[model samples]
Target: MSNPHKKEQHTGKDLPRWGMVIDLDRCVGCHTCEIACKMENDVPLGIWRSWVKEIEKGKYPNVVRSFRPTLCNHCENPACVKVCPVGAAWQREDGIVMVDPHLCVGCRYCMSACPYEVRYVHPQKGMIDKCDFCHTRVDAGLKPSCVEACPASARIFGNLNDPKSDVSKLVSTKSVTTLKPEMGTDPRVYYIGLDMATMEIKREAKLVWEK
Candidate 1:
């Protein structure tokens, strides 16, 4: 199969169920993806639509470092979508969870409901803001900003339903995991080279803002 991970001419019909694969082995904790996402989305300094989480393991003598690029998981059963009192949070057919800024009343319910803690209330706009997988760019035949900017090529985005797509192949053929499976969100974002430590949900730090 062709390396569908790269931006190229796609020959097949556009598939449904957009998703992502992040290879932890390829990630270097550079935060380039974070900067790219912020620039592309115009996310303010105090908040992040996407962030790179640094995880360190082992004692000082055997120290190991890893990076996890986190965003809205865009779950198959989105908690945010269900909890939005005004229906501001909703999931598209393709699996992106979107917040309608105009309809949002800054209630922060969706923020609380999200297990990934990717959602944040925009202090200036009084609305919720989070990753939508750069849907506008994806619609324009482009990858998400973070995926495009990762120098290590650790991020892969494509339609999960297409068996021929790189993302689908990776998930099928490799060891993969989703964050907080116990939450039963069935998140579309899959991770390669992640350990149980990385998947452990930290409830004390609730929101991205708290981090």
Candidate 2:
């Protein structure tokens, strides 16, 4: 008997341009995505290319909880791109941020320039490292490890430019937000369930620590 629910293989132009939508409402702060990302990318200990940042607000009894999974913003106007002296980092035509590992001189300029603090200097690779948006699996027509491993289905990946795409539809229907909007990075990643209170907590923390 033929299976009616078999996963279809992507081919040619049917392959979607990549984007990620994180539903904060569904996220349990489990850190599964973080572990999945590290394992799939072989990211070493003490140097995470992706991570989860948790925010707790209010006085002890009235506290509210929020979890923000942070990764390279893959900004439309990536500061890392302009700061790289060796031109190792660049934004792709489809809006993905990437680095030429061979071209990187480990100067750490990109690390300093990124407002999101997602870039890291790899000790063994001897190069600047950050999320490549799971380009390997993406190119092979598979979802990113984090997206696949998410137990809550809190993450969605697709093309922002495609009107019919799930990400585009969700953004249109939901109140989505990005981190560090003041930096004018125009981050491609979007988050749902983020509120003013959550934003305020993050803002205050950054101002205190970044100083």
Candidate 3:
């Protein structure tokens, strides 16, 4: 594994704006992605870098289970980056939001400002942490663990700036929507076939952080 702290080289050509698109229609609610993320990032037991939110709909006899995968949105106008007083939270040239654990003072300012509630204080290090799309692996030219481990192939990761990328094509051609578009964050994560009722739901797992 490459050292995650090393600064990656950047050339002046068109930088890829990395993003994701989840095809809810293809998701199986298997939680494979949830497990894969934890294994890859070594996320703490109580905290999650990513998780699947499941909800049952319809009457007893006729019911359906819907899943919403929760992770850092990596927003274009990230509130975490804007609110970080120490500049610990920053966005990469490719739109991935990252945190500098060394610079973080455990102020929790970013945690409060973030709408996604994905950020958490590392139990041991006392630094803020969250999903960075597995930057080290991505920098190594590998797909995110969740993307590769998804059995249904529901999670699509790619360069949104490139029209040829799958994520870009789906986002432009499919009926996709992002979480909290009204917040004006311009979240890079988009979802297809996301239930309208669950659009505003913050999910029970996300609330555990406050306790």
Candidate 4:
């Protein structure tokens, strides 16, 4: 078998529109995907490009545990791309938002522009970094590290434009949701069985950058 991590060259033609569907029902909040993403991307200890949000619902006797796994939404109209003074942040034709480290001046403008608050400035590298849906792996015809590492198989990744794809089918049939839709970012990431907590932003919630 070929090495899946090795980069595969592609001609600039009709490329697939990449997207992800996360089944909140299947997510067990194990944090396995978090570790895999960190390892694959060499993320720092204090911050994370991807993380799980735990929501406790109902009273003790009838309580329920729900988890929301979050990362960059790779929006269709990314605020980060517009707010970047140096044009460091950009979106690809396939709808993946990427930050060019070479162009980045560590301005943190994108961090503020993102409503989801997923983007963060790397303390060590002095550059903006966030999940790009593991573009390197996707370009290599492999699933993202997080998706591959998911023990419960909660995450499904594929072309949303292809009707035959699992992601497309699920979106068409299931009542999925995107975060902060009012922001008009048109985020590509979708969720099934999303809880109320994940939809509401809490100012008291600890930030990833907060020490």
- Please give the range of 10 consecutive residues that has the lowest summed lDDT in model 1: 2-11
List candidate 4 segments past 4 Å from native: 1-13, 203-211
Q: Give model 4 RMSD, 1 decimal.
A: 6.2
Model 2: how far residue 191 lies from native, Å: 0.9
lDDT of 3 by residue, 51-116 (tens): 888888899899898889989999988898878887788888888999987678999999999988
lDDT of 4 by residue, 1-211 (tens): 4322223333344678899999998999999999999999999987898999987888979998889999998887789888888777877777778888878899888898899899887989999999999999999999999999999999999988788999999999999999889999998899999996756677797866747
lDDT of 1 by residue, 184-208 (tens): 8999999999856665567787655
Candidate 3 Cα outliers beyond 4 Å, as residue runs: 1-13, 200-211
Model 4, residue 97: C-alpha shift (Å): 0.6
Q: Count clashing pairs, candidate 2.
A: 0
Model 4, residue 197: what's the lDDT?
A: 77
Query: Considering only N, C-alpha and C atoms within 3 Å, which residue pairs clash in candidate 4?
Result: none
Model 1 has a clash total of 0
TM-score order of candidates, top first: 4, 3, 1, 2
Better of 2 and 3 by TM-score: 3
Order of models, best lDDT first: 3, 4, 1, 2
Task: Report the C-alpha lDDT of model 2 over 135-188, residue by residue, as the tens digit.
Answer: 888888788889999999998888877879899899889889988899999898
